[model samples]
Target: MKVLYKKILDLEIWHDYYLGQPNPPKPPPTGYDISDMLALVPTPECLRVLRNLRWLFRPQPRGASIFAHVEQASSGDFATLLPVNRPEQLTFWLIVRDRYFANFTNLPLTTNRHQIYYFSNLSLNQGHALFLTQPLPNYAANSEYHLGQLVHHDGKTLEALLYQASASKNPNANDWDILPNSQYVSELDRLPQQGLSRIYTIPKANPGDIWRLTLVNVHEQETFVLDVTTPITHTPGDAIACSLNFSGQIPGCYKLCLNNIQVDRFVLCDPIASKDAFALVEIVLNQSLVPSAFSLLQPQDGNTLIKPKTYVIRCKNRATRWRYRYEKPHGFSAASLPNFELIDAKTYATKRPLGLRLQPDSLLTDGKDQLLPAPAIALIKPETDTQAHVTTIFSDIHL
Candidate 1:
């Protein structure tokens, strides 16, 4: 005789048989082992039918030890079972302890069916019949669900099985928008437009030194002259010149034309013998050219003291033509001298200073019988008790 038991979601199945009285446990039944029979009912339909079987009042009739097996479709394998039934109980708790059998599932056990079937192949194991219960739910997908089982034998003794499933794990998260912004405009737009004009130092002119003139356009745009001699020039590049013999010092003034349209007047100081003495000139233009109203002062002397041994004699303006004469010291007659380069006529209109070197062939002695060479002379007024007297000396000239 043999006994077999199986349980599903809502059903149960039990089989009872006789194995002739326990005659020295002849080799376990070869054709139909209870463990082999339990391996067949893992399908959903078999599990549902097994869950309905009644086993609450079945007594623990002792015979031979009963071996149990369970299989699951989701996990794809069969597992050994622990005897979890108490005295007089018809239900038993099945536990799978293998790690390989535990993790083999695509879906959780609660959602996937796990069929449990149990059986004994011999009547010798009749008193020790196996028990089966409902498939345990998979709480790994949602840990809140729990599964607990208790097996009762003959309605008195009990065995308990506990199962716990946890929730899926998580990682961490990140963020990125916490800083501020910065930026604005500048201040160079408020100034006036101005251009660079060349500086000119005047020259000292003796009786015959030539004068040259030049008009320079310092502005980017061309300016016109309206009336050359009336200070109303509207045309560009206009100029004029006059010749006067160097007699005793006289007040100097002149008028000119700029672009043949604008007239401008210039006043010059009396010619002096010292290098530092200078003349002033003013150029006035029409109302439209007021922004470039120009004025210049030029010296009539050509002496410049650069070093103790050197001196430079320069021409004043460019437009004026000139001749030169040299007289020997002792009452010798004056004669026109040659061998001088014609100065650039355009240089003087803009008031550029022109220079020439003076190197004496022999040292000349002064009135005091002291040897003096070609150099600059400085003029100064002496301080007296009540009035000042002027004094002149050659070493005091500034280049």
Candidate 2:
């Protein structure tokens, strides 16, 4: 199978949400897939975020690894015995589509009958499978109760009275308790709640904050700048989106930056091959994208360095230009420090005089040729000093 598109469906029962509140929260949306009687269950909410996901697992029988084929028999019943290498940890895949399945009724599961486990080779060479355990029995209007018996009621899993025997039409809060199994469902972690809109979002910014996005061509040193200001008022969950209008731009590797921080680098391919060809990029904005944090590459830390040595520092994002300052003891200072520039995508190097140490406090400029408000990041500082060798002239009398 191509496995062209796949999403994780968390096998959840109703009791997962807090029922104490006046308004109980609905269960989260789930993804689905279907073929013949074999179908993955899908909720109305999941339709918004259906996107392709890729996962790599070691060749081992995992709890959610086995794919069960639910075949509908001619007797108007769904019956199929699946041989699982690890039945105790087995999970089943249920598929339903928006157009094929309606209202989630006539589900093929027969919970009253004991689910049989068989043994054989049933490896799936098709697409991936999402496993859901055989659901428990639905709650009855009135039923004899026992301790630890599990039942499904109103989309939740509840257990019987822990230490008492009773008959209750409506399950009492004390008589029944939500079980941990109710919370066992896989979440679509990588899928964004807002769906995949080809745009960039910067998080945690106040209203009316000015953000600048610069796209610099690496080879030509050409720059394209776009500035955006956050609206004074917007919806509660709305994010500040950075514009990516690459009009009048050429095809090359472009280093991207949001404000003074280097957010990403991408290549704009030549569109001559196909008019519909385009690139989609996503980036999360937070402290994680801060460009100030970098590592000292050359002159390993705590090592003594000789004079006129070149020091290199590497950052998470490529720096177009760099700033450096050298400090010496006894008030001695270099007349001019080397103007460190991008030696590579993420590295910056400069030759400095011996007997001086680089300060840990450093900053990266927002633009290549322009000075803007840049954030301060830690720089290289080898605690050790450069050993200065002084030569004495003993032949001064000949002069």
* Each model's lDDT: 0.20, 0.30
Give the runs in model 1 whose Cα sits over 4 Å from its true position. 1-358, 366-370, 377-399
Superposition TM-score, candidate 2 onto the true structure:
0.20
For candidate 1, give the lDDT of residue 348: 8
TM-score for each predicted model, relative to the true structure? 0.11, 0.20
Compared with the true structure, the alpha-carbon lDDT of candidate 2 equals: 0.30
State the lDDT at 398 in candidate 2.
8
Report how far off residue 189 is in candidate 2 (Å): 28
Best by TM-score: 2
Give me the overall lDDT of model 1. 0.20
**Per-residue lDDT value at 363 in model 1:** 43
Q: Tens digit of lDDT per residue, candidate 2, span 352-394?
A: 1111111223332322433323312222121212332111101
